[model samples]
Target: MNGYRFDKLKLLVADDNQHMRKLISTIMKAFGTTSVYEAESGEAAWQSLKKIGIDIVIVDWQMAGMTGLDFVRKIRNAPDSPNPFLPVIMLTGYTHIDHVRLARDAGANEFLAKPVTVKALMAKITSVIENPRPFVRTKTYFGPCRRRRNDMSYKGPERRAAPDAIDVDGIRPVGSGKTGSHGP
Candidate 1:
């Protein structure tokens, strides 16, 4: 808590429940975040994002107008999004691994379970602040890099080789559209 300074951060708390919104906002205030805005629905939150210079967004998974997953997807993939790189933390009671993966795939930077606490909230905020993931733009994905680690020492069958190099599995990617046999 003392290590991180949220005084300069402008956060948005988007939840359908007014009480949950208030609780999260109070926690943000305790963290010294002065500009914490609240939105009762995902649509309102999206509107706020376009208007506010928000540094981070804390959204609930279950919202009326738009689900948290939908909001995150829009933020990451929307053609005219205000800031695609904005950090997003999904706060919800859905602690299942599937739910977490869904949030990650949807472009939320981090996921926090419900029954939120000051310590947990602070930790999540600091994690987002201290460690920002690089954005990836693949054909189907356009958000933070999903992989958390890049273990260079691990020798595995799936290890990625250079584009022009042959893999350990003897699968050579066709280079410059030159068709060739896989024989050595």
Candidate 2:
């Protein structure tokens, strides 16, 4: 709260549960976010996103129709998506690592486990604003860069030459007249 302010942000809370929506809305309001909107289903949330100008989105994973995962996929992969780069904070009770990975793969900018707290929620928001992740776009993926930090300790197969090209380490160049792998 020192250098960051939420007063001017327009945030959306999308959840099927009424109490959860209210609680999140209350928390955002407390954080000085005046323009907070709520949607009961992912469909409604998608509509809101297409209609209004949303700064950030906090979406629940589970919903009646068009689950949060689907919504995120649409935002990231859909041709007519309103905003592909819009910041999204995935809200879910599933704290499992697999769930986290799933959310990340789906293009969420951040993740917030359920039973949300002021500190944790604010931390997510601030991180998104203060330190935005570079967007990644490839043939199979489009979203925030999954890597959080650089690791020089170990080596792994490099997948792409640039963010837009898939240059795998063990793949033959097309039309090179070579029909074999490059490396192990």
Highest-TM-score candidate: 2
Please name the candidate that would achieve the greatest lDDT relative to the true structure.
2
Candidate 1 backbone collisions, by pair: none
The C-alpha TM-scores of every prediction are 0.80, 0.81
Name the 10 consecutive residues with the lowest summed lDDT in model 1.
Answer: 175-184
Off by more than 4 A, model 2: 150-184
For residue 128, model 1's alpha carbon misses the true position, in angstroms, by: 0.4
What lDDT tens digits, residue by residue, belong to model 2 across residues 81-165?
9999999999999876556657777888888987898888988888889778777666678988665542334265534332212
